[model samples]
Target: MLAESPPETEQSAPPPVARPRHAARAAGLLIALAVLALVAVASIAVGAKPMSLDEVWHGLFHYSGTVNDVVVRDLRVPRTVLGVLVGLGLGLSGAVMQALTRNPLAEPGILGVNAGAAAAVVSAISFFGAATLDEFIWWAFLGAAVVSAAVYALGGSRSATPVRLALAGTAATAALVGYINAVQLMDTKALDKLRFWTVGSLASATMDTVEQVAPFLLLGVVLALTLGRPLNAMAMGDDTARALGAHLTRTRILSMTAITLLCGAATAACGPIAFVGLMVPHLARLVTGPDMRWVLAYSAVLSPVLLLGADVIGRVVTRPSELQVGIVTALIGGPVFIYLVRRKRMAQL
Candidate 1:
């Protein structure tokens, strides 16, 4: 006799969500959005100088120009807005990257985008005497785009596999990082200018910085949101995606462009923020159950929640002195990432 079939439950896949489930997911998205709003407000209100809710309200609408108002207008608002935009870009890019590669471990920086940006920024300060965000931001974006294109060519161009692309990106990142290290070590002036940015805190956030990056981030968001259905189809396999009219070449090209825009601008504005891109998309998938559409939506909203929450936590945890936001995220995310890796199912998600 043939071996007994495995239990049906063991092989069963998750079913498509019903209307009720969709409604629930929608409600959850709204809740996540509300949490993001609260976190953004907290970022503004709960700094070294904590402000009351009433003060925060006045700081927003009224124009008394008090010390508190100046602090809010000049400092907190820019930081909060930059955090939101950067967080949004990171999360969406990560989700798109993972979907494009069909690799659960992929992130926004998996393409060496951050490394490219940092190298350019450092070179600007060291060799070109470009200190301000205005001058260096453009350099960073240019470097990121150029490096990513080089990585793509090395990864096999049109015939690139996920593994090849990842390997190419890794090699590029290591080389770029070495270059950045050499530059910073040789120039103390560059090191002093870069110290804050390299740590990935929002301390240097300015309205000008936010204004420079916002358009790129918003355009990236629109492009990313459009790829959801195509990504979902591609997740089933390239053949299946092609069968479903997904146009694999077009999707992949668009995905790369969007990732470059999103990651480059975020990195240029705020430096390389660790773990926001890596961790948020996995959490989004956990909540949304692998539907790329819901995954993208949830990531867009929830990533900012995590980033701003981490920023706020960093602010209050050390009192007068504070931890950098990147440090805080790495501290929290490392353990979570270990836990995720240990769970066999998470790698498949």
Candidate 2:
């Protein structure tokens, strides 16, 4: 009788890939890391002033407060470090979000973090007279955190579904973006202060900014990398995920927490960079297949490459006058967005 009662218990788990495929994926991941390292070096050495390799080396290891040293040590170094951190954060958050929502277009912004941070930063400049990057960063993080919590609650809290969360985020983003526009238009004096922050850039980064964001970024990275298993189960559908003993509610909560940490710190550090989150995960999934674990690994490694590469291009394209990294990424991300929309069915999660 006990044996006969188990007919319904035979649902299969997602099958593992063959060992050969695993080895190939691992090789690709290592190559991605190599690209990331090279991009980071380019970020430090190829800014507007264009330091040489020797200068970059001395700036990192030996410093004498010379002009080149200052440029290398004080400016490009922080920018490069922040770029990598922000890129990693965005990539991981994006990949995790797509996995959580099972929506091809899901990104960190889908939770309203970008809108929330923007609104808060605007308010700080317009209402609170917060003029410095220091002031805006704190307000941005606070706003992102609060709005994310609100969106979670609005989305149904413990019982939240992907559709509900997406709807809630859209609603919240619309409301906050409207508020930001009204405030900025009414208070044109604040526009100058808000303009660069809103559009996003890493030019304002300092060592202090790096210190402020490192802890949250590290924690978020760890949390996200660990979610590959449950997220993989989740990809198999909710009923199947439950059958596989995945803790759906806890996973959702943790996922949101990681997003808030990663996206909030990243936005606060360097405004809100676009497309790194939106596009990087899709690219990662393309290379790593549908396996959430490998996709996440690739996303983490490759996201920084896209971001810092964009940052370097932004520096060189305009000669003495550089474009913002945000602008550069937008220019790139727009075509990708169109391509995604035109496709009949996007590459699966």
- What lDDT does each candidate get? 0.83, 0.83
Could you give candidate 1's per-residue lDDT for residues 202-288 as a string of tens digits?
A: 888899999989998999999999999999998888788899998998998899889888988888888877667778888887788
Off by over 4 Å in 2: 1-17, 129-138, 145-175
Per-residue accuracy of model 2 over 1-349 as CA lDDT, tens digit each = 5565444445453346676788899999989999999898889889888667898899878999999999998999899999999999999988888888776766656568777987888888888888765676678778877887888689786466656776898899889878988998999898876677777898888988899888888899999999999999998888999999999999988998888788878887787777788798888777887888998899998889998999999999998878999899989987986677578765445
The local distance difference test score of model 1 is 0.83
How far in Å is the alpha carbon of 174 misplaced in model 2?
Answer: 5.2
After superposition of all CA atoms, the RMSD between model 2 and the true structure is 5.6
The collision pairs in model 1 are none
- List ranges where model 1 is wrong by over 4 Å: 1-17, 149-174, 346-349
Error of 1 at 106 (Å): 0.7
Reference-based lDDT, residue 77, model 1: 94
